[model samples]
Target: MTVELTTLAAIVAMAAATVLTRLSGLLLLRYVNFSPRSRRALDAIPPAVLMAVVAPTALATGPAESAACLVTALAAFRFPMLAAVALGVATVALLRFLGL
Candidate 1:
């Protein structure tokens, strides 16, 4: 199917807007001087962001999937980061294979 010029332009604009929206926070952080409290809050943002991104995906697949993710996260916390991720992926794969 051929996309019309106007449709293509709209898609490009939407992509640009999405990119700018994602980057706006980082840009502001780089350019603005944040207070100590703000810095602490900023430090907390990553874990919060990670949860926000991962929670739904994990839960969407059910408790077993979420448990696998949690295990992987905990392993990563206790062991090598790469190993943790590998274990998590492997756990999910195994579970899928076993028909969980």
Candidate 2:
């Protein structure tokens, strides 16, 4: 497969940027002391970021995906995360199969 020079350069640049971002966060943390409340807030960032990314796509996709998102959210409240995820996957598959 032939890769274009610009595409390759873009991919390499993205990788470098991602590495720099992660390394900068690690290095910055070493010099900073956070309160317990601040630490807890920092810890919550990852899931919030994940949901921020996933929620919009889920809601925008279609009826099946939207329904699956709701099912997953409700499932998450009552079941383990893994179970909730599995149920969401199954729900989407079933809904799609049924032509929703």
Candidate 3:
């Protein structure tokens, strides 16, 4: 089925709105000053954001996935970031291979 003009326009508008919403923070960064406290907070943001994104997925997937993520996170904490990521990916792959 073909999409109507109004529906297409609505989709375009929604896409633009989503893009702008995501970019708003970066755009505002140009006007803002980074203080020491803000810098520290920014450093913490990546781990917090990563946990937020990963936790739900792990929980939804089950214990095996959660264990994989934990192993990966711990490795990342103790070694090179790339190695940690690789550990996590490898754990997931191994788990899948084992039919877990």
Candidate 4:
């Protein structure tokens, strides 16, 4: 089957756009020096965004999820973000398996 010209152009354009966007972020950050406060704020962004997205779904799902979410939030304070997320997922899985 032959690829249409417009489809091939669209695919190339999207790839170019994605590469440019990523390179722009790296280039922009190379010149900027963050203050301690600004740095801390930037560091907090990932977990904050994760919670903002997860919390509502957890609350709506049921007690097992809500409890798991709490455990995950507590873990985040003591562990790295990846560890915290893993613990949260494990907690939810265990709780669900236990029929909670």
What is the per-residue lDDT of model 4 for residues 48-94, given as tens digits with 9 covering 90 to 100? 88788788977798988998899888887778999999999999999
lDDT digits (tens) for residues 17-56 of candidate 1: 9999989977876888989998888666555555566677
Q: After superposition, how far is residue 17 of candidate 1 from its true place, in Å?
A: 2.0
Q: Please provide, for model 3 over 12-99, each residue's C-alpha lDDT reduced to its tens digit, 9 standing for 90 to 100.
A: 9999999998899789989999999988788666566666667787778876698888987677456766677788888988988888
Q: Which pairs clash in model 3?
A: none
How would you order the candidates by TM-score, starting with the best?
4, 3, 1, 2
Candidate 2 Cα outliers beyond 4 Å, as residue runs: 1-11, 74-87
Per residue, candidate 2 scores C-alpha lDDT tens digits across 1-100 of 9999999999999999999999999999999999999998886665455456558958689999989888877776667667877898999999999999
lDDT of 1: 0.75
Q: What's each prediction's TM-score?
A: 0.59, 0.55, 0.67, 0.78
**Against the hidden true structure, what lDDT does model 4 obtain?**
0.90
Pick by TM-score: 2 or 4, better one:
4
Q: Best-fitting candidate, measured by TM-score?
A: 4
lDDT per model, in order?
0.75, 0.83, 0.79, 0.90
lDDT of 3 at 13: 100
